[model samples]
Target: MKQIGVALWLLFLPFVLFTAQAQESKPLSVDVLWQIERIGSPQISPSGEYIVAPVTRYDMDTDKGESQLWLFSPDGKTQRPLTAEGLRASQPTFSPDGQALAFISKRHKDDVGQVYILPMNQPGEATRLTSVPTGAYGIKWVGEHIYFISKVWPGKNWDDIAEQVKHEANSHVSAHQWNALPYAQFDHWLDENREAHVFRIPATGGEVQAVTQPLNIQLPRSSQSASSYDIDPSERYIALVSDSLNDGVSPNNDIFLAEIGATEATNMTPQNRGNDYNPMFSPDGQVLAFQRQLITGFYADTSNLVVYDLNKKTEKVLTEDWDRSVRGLVWTANSRGLFGTIDDAATSRVYAINARNGKVKALTGETNFSGLSISNNGILVGTNDSFLHPAQLVKIDTRNGSTTRLDTFNDALLADVELGTYESVTYKGYNGDDIQMWVHYPPGFDKSKKYPLFLLIHGGPHGAISNGFHYRWNAQTFASWGYVTAWHNFHGSSGFGQEFTDSINPDWVTAPYADTIAAANWFAEKDWIDADRMVAGGGSYGGYLSTILLGKEHPFNALLIHAPVYNMYSQMSADFAVHAERFGHYWEKPEIYRDISPHYYADKFNTPALIIHGQKDLRVPVGQSFELFRTLQSRGVDSRLIYYPDENHWILKPNNSVYWYQQVRNWVEQYATPGAQ
Candidate 1:
């Protein structure tokens, strides 16, 4: 009898241990979350034989994102890490010679980025170039000098004007001064002194020279800000985009050609109604190529690539009829044509256009190609399935267009996990408009069993869901965990055309919500989706929509809102100043803002919600999340708020991102279970 009793106790011990372990898994940490690896900003060597890109990997154990510079040959035969410091190195550009490379590293303790040069043959410590307080960006090689864009303090006169405006805006102070101050006033203060100027420093070593002064051309208060300037191949003129006259109200950006070493600048495209940017000169410096957008009211027309002949003084559109934006341009060695990517919706394809005749031919048939470069031997292109796929460097034969995949950033890790396949689905939306969405089925999915569904909304009512793979908390990992995720490019989303993108203006919130609901209904009608256990979530604009959807319906068992806008009056009044121009002033359109606000109808919220917002999120302040949490708490609704300190609008820290996803997974499992909350 004693022996039998001991055996029974031993059997019960295992069960007890299992139960304890399962219970301990509560309050999920970052390790259990999904991991994503990505490669960004691929740059081909000047010789076009090698490609360099910033490869980022997240380690679950340490919860940190490690970025390194990686080099790959054109044939994809040889690929290796260029730097092993475990520091963040990005924007790699080959020196004029293929033997050396220049990159930006933030390894210094000063918290400022400095230029570093490393020899390809003898890999050792990189040579530091600049030690300025503010970091450098958009570094390019011009002869033996390196040209970059840096931000410095504006002149005293500008600072005084900025200070006066701040003083006047705050003439009336209340007890809730910090909360009541309009967010636009703060934005105006931040931009008053910031300007992009061209600076040059020696490649080897020397003091940096400021080539473009802020006073050279005053920007208009209503125009968009200026960015880095590009140097012509001859290094005689610097090309830059600025709205010095518009005062930040319009999107009309004029390209300026300033002679090297001279402060005088000439407006290349002097259109006051349209916007132009990303100016680049042909190899021979005879033709200038740039992108222009026509803005009408709240909508912007599709941007097109235009070429201006310096000698002939003629400007012509290279892709006039193409209903897409030409993003990146690289001139061929002969300078007769150029290779660029035509970005349409979320799909991008490589195209070669004749500079003289405005004729275009697709180089990459159906695959997404970006970060393209051309050389005498062949063309190097970065290819990916969707935004989530770590792009692989590929060499396409300019002669025959035969493609060969070269080096991949995180191919080894990606091999361990299978990726879901995306299929384009079209459904009839409100007013019979064709609504397009991309559905991603889980990897190794068993068609025999139904899977849970997640409806992911993209932010930017103007933002469209694309075919590209996303690295941050992407749908692939959810699919890996046995869930089918669908991303709908609802109305007001960009890339389809101007009319579709502009539909959200004035209406602001209802049109997008209707589109999302239509997508949900479509998924419900599908056989694979388990309508009983559906989850809905999104970040930023998507987050706002998710919260609103919760108040509108209780179909979703679980809801996740990341950096959502809950109160429109408070948000529009306290949000970024750019919102005033982007969405219009709430004072002028009070009814429109109030009727579309999610907070006004918070009492209708019924679904359990998990709110996530960055503590330092400037774009969508954490207060928005707090307000919703308070409302839900008062109403006895199930809601929880997770704050990530040191994170911004987008979570960049690896461990934090992983932890965020784990929390999401746990929340979904809790509510989306069989007969749960």
Candidate 2:
């Protein structure tokens, strides 16, 4: 009996050790599952030998995001953290001498971003420059002083006009008393206050100077207001966009150039309509390059690059025939030409356009290039896939355009992890429109077996599904879980031309819905996709579309809608008051709003839908999701509502984001199965 007992004890020892090792090797917390960090705002030194950027890291244990200043040599051999302390540091701008680095930090615990300067040689404590309540934006070194945009109080002139409008609103309320209380209250607050003005503070901290007065220059009547102004390198002139001449009643924005230290400002862009923004001065200050949007409403028109020659006093179109819009413009150091990133179809590429002849040459081929920076040595391009991976910073040779990867943020994490294969595809829509889409095959996908399909819709009814890596709760996660995912940059999506984007504006909801359905039909035709196990999910405008699709009895087995807008009337009228002007008057466009709203037809919904919304989503109010959830429950539909109390429109908190992902996984497992309950 003693010998038998000893033998049993030895047999149990290996089993206990195996169990301990298994527990140690359990999968990481969901919060750290897809976390990625990269070098943001990489700025090469003036001498082109050193690179300075804010390197961000997401801490899963603390559930907080941290960043610090890091310096790297040109050869990518030596790298070290310049700032050891964990604080949010971003937007590194090097001084002309390259002896010091200037950046913005929120480390003071006041929730205000202040400018801090650090010496390159000494590496001591960062010195705070600006001490104000409103914080600083657009920090640039202009001569000896650092120029930034700060909010300042508008004078009595604007206050008097605001008071007059208030009194008139109050009088109208008194006349109708109970009948017009809501209208009166909204009108009074919306029309009462003047917007924030831009002020220039000294880099070394002194009395700030108001560059643009609120009353003197009026804002465009559009829903989006101007926030910052840019000064030329010469410091002789400042460029701004405002609607002051229109008495705040016109949607038109005109670019104005004002002489520094003078009240006189001249309207450089005299257009009565369209948006002119991102004005950049040439190296020699002889010409200016800016972006101009030529349309109004949702799917209005494509924006193009326009160049203004100060010496010739004329403006010309640089990318006139290029249907894709130019963005992320960086004028070459020599100022002879300009380089920018343009999106065509779904792929983003870098292009260099001749400043004189308007001839464009593709630089970085088909890869999506972002966080672009140019130095005397060459251009630092951050490139990545649109669906799966984080961006990798690479140095491109100017003469040969040979790419060399400097730093990969997720190389170690993605080494053994399998990634979905992406391919560009196209399908015909209901109106015979050629809809372009991208499909993500499941990791280690098998052609012999049918897999679940997830139709991922991008937000922005005006936005596009690009070739760049998506950093949010992306479709790659679904692919990792053995589900095929497809994303379409449907009509009304940007990156194509203005004509394509503007098509869905007035009747914004239906056209994209058709494109999404077309994508689903295309996927169903494929033998590898299981047509019965289809799910639809999205956030923001994408969320709105998901809800709409659920109500339409599409083939989708389940739906995940995040912060969606169900009722167009409530969304445009009350929830998004700041954007009310974009939809025009509710009375004037009542039929248009009613026709596009998904909530009006909620009784038709049959799909099991999971609703997730951030409680503090000021952009798309939580009330929108609440209404949809309540309506779905009333109709006896299989619906679940999950609210993140401390989250905003975008889930940024680490713990909340993890919870959201877990809920999505659970929903997919439960309702997305064959004959699921």
Candidate 3:
């Protein structure tokens, strides 16, 4: 009996050890993802001694996330939260003296977000700085005054606006009327009657004074943020972004320059038909720099950096010859060069552009860098992340492009999470041109084993898949489910130069569709990929492409379409129509719409698919997904439709997102089957 018991114990010991090892090397899941803290862009002080960023944490039970300001030392040694937990805080701006910090938050009796100021060098509670009924955002602490942007009813004072808001909330009428082109943006409806303007208040707390409201010029109706306007160092002048046309239909964004107290502002870019915004004044206030795009309808047009000499009142295009778009521009201390995050060849890199001659130099290579903030002493701090890691605050050495991690918010959560490896591979796509793609291998991946393929298509048709950590459609998360994932940057994807981006202009079908097909063929030849168990899909334009696949021949065993644009003609009902301004409308170019619209080939629907859409998605209306789902059901094809009424373009709620991932896993596993065969 003792010998038999010893043998049984030995057999059970091996089973227990295997279970412990499996738990130790757990893959990323939706529950674990919610536990990771998300760090926003860092704001460096004028002296570069102090840096502050907003860190947000989510609660699964509450299905909400709260942000708090966090302070970090320049040497990357000290880090702590500046605000109490459970309260939301954002848009941290440092005072010119670097002794105080100001941010927007809603606390205590505040019904909306108000400006709160805190002492940096001393221990003290934050004090409310503004009581405006409309609330404030996009704050900047410049000179002796704090500037902020707020949307208010036109010609209404603080008292009247407060009363109006109360009455509206109590009113029974729920209908919204709009007599304009842009009635909605992404998820929410825009108040056409209200106008967004800049306002200023004394740092010590006093009466609010309207800056642009008195000038009778308002920021763009569709959107307005910190990038909408800029104040000069002397606080003598202001440059703002305003629309050249007020009718809303095909409005052109142009920069307007005005004196600090003047009631009239001059239109600076009236000759340019395309959009020109993000007016940034140089350190010396000698030049005002902004971005310009020549094409009227294409939102992904190349953004060229242009400078205006304040003294001479002349405009010069600094990046006219460059193909890449200039984003997140920051003027150097000396005003001789500017650093910007540019999307280049499937990567978001930091590039230095000479202010005088437009000579461009690459600063950082690999991964993704965003929310660039530079101090007067030339300390660059930004948020950096990659496929295997979440966003981390880093101090970048401007000269050498070296980076030192500043904050360790998500370090502990990610320490034990076994992440998959990814690589950028180039393959011959449409027209025999090389297309770049990111391929992710599952954790403990072996070349000797055959795995299923999860092909993810990116939207924007113009938005390339750069190296960044994405929570919504994470490649590693899918790869963890025992499948190899890949994102193909097909034709029309940006960051590959202007010609490649514009190749699919009027016809959004031919080139991209062919490129996707080629990508699958390239993967089918891979020794590790099991072509028989391949699945493909995407969101938005990616979904449109998936619908295109539904009507055509492909190697995919299943499709996952999210928020797709099914019918080109019905797409005009969306807040922003596709190809209406650049290309003629469907009535004018009926052949183009008929030939490319996915709904036109509904008879060919045969593939099993999981369709997901949100009701509030105005970009690609929820009806698009419903239309495709209905078509699939009518044809007796295996399909599943998951509707999210509260979600917008993306699944955001904690519980809803977890459910979405589970449904996706279940649907994919039923068809393709995960793990090595």
lDDT winner: 3
| Per-residue lDDT of candidate 2, residues 1-677 (tens digit) | 99999999899989988777555542222443546666675777766766877778877788888888777766777567877667788778777667788888877564578778888867488888876565666677666667665443456443454455456656746443332112212112232243445566666667767667732774332332222356677888777777534543334566788787777788877763666777788777888888787754222356678888887899998777877788777888778887777776677777787888888887766567766677654555444444555676667665555677766566666554556688888888748898888888765577777888888888877777877766565666667666787888888887777678777767866788888888888989888888888888899889988988876757888998988988776774332332244666658767777777888778798788899987667668778999999998988988999988878778877777878878888898676662211
**TM-score leader:** 3
Residues 527-640 of candidate 3 have per-residue lDDT tens digits of 999999999989999999999999998899999999999999889888886797888888998998999999998999999999999999989999998889999999999999
Query: Which sequence of candidate numbers ranks them by lDDT, best first?
Result: 3, 1, 2
For model 1, state the Cα shift of residue 450 in Å.
2.9
lDDT of model number 2: 0.71
1 or 3, which is superior by lDDT? 3
Structural similarity to truth (TM-score) of each candidate:
0.83, 0.85, 0.97
lDDT of 1 by residue, 1-677 (tens): 99999999999999999777555532111332234455665777767777787777777677677789877777678778888757889878777676778888888574667788887767477878877655676788867788876655555343453465456467875323232222233223234445556677988888877777733753332222223357777788888877745444334567888788885888987764567778888878898888877763333457778998888988998777876666667788777988876655656767777888878777665456677766544455665555346466677666555578776555555544445576888998867899888887775566666778788988876767666656565776666556777888888787787678777776766778888888888988877667887898999889989988877954688799999988876674343442455557778767777777899887788778999988767667778999999998888899999998788778877667767777888888787652212
The list of candidate 3 runs beyond 4 A from truth reads 1-22
TM-score of 3: 0.97
- Position 506, candidate 2: lDDT: 72
